[model samples]
Target: MTLFSLVATHADLDLETVGILSSGAADVAGSVDVPAVTLATCNRLEIYAEASSDDPAALEASREELIDAVAETSGVDRDTIASTFRTLVEDDAVSHLFQVGAGLDSAVIGEREIAGQVRKSLADAQNAGTVSGHLTRLFETATRTAKDVGARTALGSRGRSIVSVSLDIAGDMRGDGAAFYRDACVVLIGTGAYAGTSLAQLQERGVRDIAVFSGSGRAEQFVAERGAAARALKMEELSEAFSAADVIIGCSGGNRQITAQEIRTLAGIGPEGREKDLTVIDLALSHDFTPEVADLPGVELITLESVKMAAPAETEDSLEQAREVVDAAVQEYLTERQQRSADDAIVALRRHTQSVLDAEMEKVRKQHGCTAAAEEVEFAVRRIVRKLLHTPTVRARELAAEGRTEDYVQALQDIFGLEVEPRERPEREQPAKRRRAEEFTPAELAQMAAHLQKVPDGGFCPHHRPGEFAVERLEVAQRLTQAQAS
Candidate 1:
């Protein structure tokens, strides 16, 4: 199956529209016919799906299906959903996911949180039984690629995020930089992932007095579970909490917009009674605080928009390093996927050869009555067959990686009279074994990390050329064939 994705991110739509799209993202998978994974973050809502074919018309139909499902579920109009969501097909889809997992696509570039979110989206799809083998590999590779980028580049090492950027802006607004965090009485309105991240970041900056409020009444549970030495604010306690808080962070992922008037009324502050400076950070896609809150006396607001505008530009060296890693990863993933396309042809050719060997062995057994000589002949014949098949096997992979698997299959059909119908091996019986993340030793990883810094464009070292490597391998195989023939 060909992979495609319908992506509606903050880049395409306003954060509010993204939030609206994300609200019902969980249900979109149920409406689609194909194996699907829905990645619904605060600023992005994407459905990565496996379509039946890579044909443009077929992919367009698949896109329409996904769009209809999202429109129905999200209550976004069909036209808007169709126009807003970017449809990425096959290679483009794969590349986009890798970029996203590497945090290159984040609002706060190189933010560490998105990698985990991408992984979680895969897990969520698996849990819901909506994931396929293709999609599973896609996401797993994306995660692994992200880890590689994180390890090899300076991009993701700092664990940057909306929370961190917001805090930085808040600190600057407070005129004390990060030192202001230590003395700030922070009130966090959210118990979700962003809130948890925000809480961790706040504590990391030496903030001590913190309170969490969940609109869904999970504040107490969230506080207890997180092991934070902070209080959970009850609904009635919000007024007191807001009034006392020096910094208010909103990440509750709720729809109720906490308006300027609401904050004023809740905090018991009036037009003439504005007492202390307050920093309001609305990190939620569905903003918890209204935009007008920035108008309040002594109030400084940091919304996602503000963060996007104020977010520091990444150093070119770090960004270039990350992109190199991602590009290499994308090419590798595509080559592997392309090679897998030849599996059925390879299996067919091998089975055909095995049948020929079996028939010849049957004749030998009939003639020799299972003698030692018969066994010897069988062994020699099998060895010869393996040697003869080796080049075909290698060529199959090479052809497939070059997107010429159809030619390989046609050659087999013409030469061996083998008609191979493509078939998927059962998941349990799948042959390709991916190298696990843990397989690399620390020393090897360090070498790779160092190589990334030194390697120029195309992500290959001076010692290796991909084209030359493939040519050398094929030449070696040809020499082996010549030796066997001689």
Candidate 2:
């Protein structure tokens, strides 16, 4: 089977489309015949599937199947769904997932939440019985790479998220900065994971006057479970909750949109019938509040779009370090996957050798009549066969790692007339085609050296020893210098 990914994110589509797709496309994983994982986050709706065949026509059919599944479940137009998704195959697909798991593709860079979301997506696929061994390994590797990125980069120290970024925008708009979070009368909408996280963050920021309202009517139980840090709001008390709140946060993105008129009627009602300033921060993907609310007087609005625009940029050094981790991790995964392709050929060679050994031993037993000489001859022949097979076995793995499995298979066919079973070997870009040290300036090399120093010792494989990457680059530079002199 071949790997493929269909990605629709805020970078390519509007947040409304993403939200709608994520919420509505629940049965997408099961709709396909192959192993599939659907990662539906607020910012992206991604489908990772292992196609039953690697043929171009078969891959296209798989894409059509997924599009049909999503459209059927989400009530979205088939053409629209097709247009919104960007298909990635093999290496690109694997790299994209790693980037997402590492939080490098999130609205807020290095956000820790996407990593867990990635893991949960895999689990959901498993529960749905749509996951395969390859898909499981792919997701598990992505999760590990994400954790490695977090531990090795400055992103772990920052711990920023979409919620935090939204609050930062709210704080800036309120004019008192973060200090306003301490005294703000905040009302949170929704009782989901985001709502729980927002509550914890609010409490961490010293906000005590917090109330939570669940459109699904679970706020009472949710608040009770969380203790006294927050209070639950009944649907009838929304007017009063809005009137008393300084900051409103929407996390429960449900079918119903909180209309502009509803907020204008009850928001910030002073005792003297005056409207006070209010900041409405909508972090929901489906938008808990209407966009028209921003037009209301004395009200400010912060949305997922606004938060995305206001997301702070990470330091270049930290970002580069994180990217190096991702690159290394992707390379390691690709190497291991490629090495596995050699297994069938190795088995075929060993099987053929064993059959020949058994035939020769039978002849020896017939000629020597089961004498000690026959046993001695069998032992020597078996030892010789093993010794002869060692180089070919090692060569098979080396060739496969270099994306030359076909060459090794052809060699076996030519030399031994061995017919190995055809296996799926996804095509990958050769590493030599990547950027070389000869293409970089001295200053760039120096910067790379500095970044390499920040990378933790060792790598995903023993072949990648500490500082080995740096050594390779320097060797390339020296080779270039020698060629120029010659």
TM-score winner among the candidates?
1
Candidate 1 lDDT over residue span 1-486, tens digit each: 678998888787888789888877888887788889998876789899987765688778878898899889878789988888888888999999999999999888998889989999999888887888789889999999999999999997867887798899999888887678888899998898899999889889999999999888998999899899789999999888888989899988676889989988877667764678788898888788888998887788888888887888899999999999999999999888767768878899889989989998999899779999999999999999999989999999889878888799789879989887546435653778865546756565555545444444343456765344332112333343445446
Compose the digit string of candidate 2's lDDT tens values, residues 1-486: 679999999899889889988866658988778779999888999999977766788899888999999988888898998998999999999999999999999989998889988999899887777887788889999999999988888976688988888887888888776689888999999998788888988988899799998877899899888885888998788889889899999989788988888887767543343456889988889888999988777788899999888899999998999999999999999888777768888989999999999998898788778888888888899899999999999999989879888788778889999987645435343665667656888777655555544444443234566655543446644444445446
Candidate 1 residue pairs in backbone clash: none
Model 2 CA RMSD to the hidden true structure, in angstroms:
17.7
In model 2, what lDDT does residue 90 have? 95
lDDT of each: 0.84, 0.84
Write down the worst ten-residue block by lDDT for model 2. 453-462
Off by over 4 Å in 1: 352-391, 401-403, 409-486
Compared to the true structure, candidate 1 yields what TM-score?
Answer: 0.79
